[model samples]
Target: MQEITDETELRELIGEPLPRAWEKERTSLHELDRAWLAASPFCLLATAGADGSCDVSPKGDPAGYTLVLDEGTIAIPERPGNRRVDSLRNILTNPHVGSIHLIPGRGDTLRINGRARLVRDAPFFDDMVVKGHRPVLAIVVEVEQVFHHCSKAFLRSQLWQPETWAPQAVPPRAVLAQTLERPDATLSDLEDYYGPSYADGLYRGQ
Candidate 1:
């Protein structure tokens, strides 16, 4: 095995940039971009720790949970999830973060690079509440760069193709609860508890 230690060798191995439409088509975020971000119900958050360890987590809600505060700032409400807080921990240790927001059946994705801070104020939470749910903590990001990611990945994966979609047969919540040591729980019990109160619990701070 040979290792290339020189810039000449490295450039030869990787070659020059390929011709890409996106390379010449870069655009800044405008009102339309904000509208798109507001309509997206999901996003992928990427963060890195002080030691360079990285984590990417998915966040979602009905829609508009992520707010475009301005051309250079955005706020994402932290909804209920597994509670691991990998992304939050990384942000606390290292302020840099990246995010990609996606809307189902939509080709354009909003990509943002920013610095993140955890906000726990009541007014911020009050502004985020939807359907009577409020997030306890929100991630406020000061955007450094914002751009649109083209649709190649979605096209390649056929993500929005109806025929390619799979049925939703995820395991019953009770099974997971039981595995986690809640032995006496039932699906109905879990659903009854979650269905009625989950929205409120998740949007508590909002």
Candidate 2:
């Protein structure tokens, strides 16, 4: 197999991007972008460290979880999760981040690129409280590039179609955890840990 090492070769194969693609980007949020943020409950945050290592973390909360500080700034609440903090560590090293916001049943997504910083406390923390828990930290982004992505990929995957869903087609989460992550744990124990009530502890920080 051969690789195309230059943009010239890559573009020759993929063809030039449509002019509208270039025209769609904005340096700040439009009214539509704010509306999109209001309705989106989830986003994928992409970050790279100073050494160029990368991480993509999924952030989800109720809709409007990402607060718009201004047309060019936004804040995302950090909910409890596996404490890896890969994205946060990367942001400390390299401020740049890219995020894609998504809403269920919607193929198009809102893309945001910006510089980010972590804040331990802010006046807005009170607004982010859910289930009596407020985020200990939040990611504030100075937006640079914002755009709406087209839906070709979602359309091809039929990701929003209920008929194509087959969540049980593979091994259950409990089985997988026991087989790959916790070999010493019994299947029954793993099942009890990840059973139907798994979501009950989402915001309960350990």
Name the weakest run of 10 consecutive residues (lDDT summed) in model 2: 197-206
Model 1 lDDT per residue over 9-113, tens place? 997998876676346333346787788887899999999999999999998887888887767778898876777899999989999998999999997788888
The residue pairs that clash in candidate 2, if any, are none
- State the displacement of the C-alpha of residue 145, model 2, in Å, after optimal TM-score superposition: 0.2
Q: How accurate is candidate 2 locally (lDDT)?
A: 0.94
Error of 1 at 53 (Å): 1.7
Q: lDDT for every model?
A: 0.81, 0.94
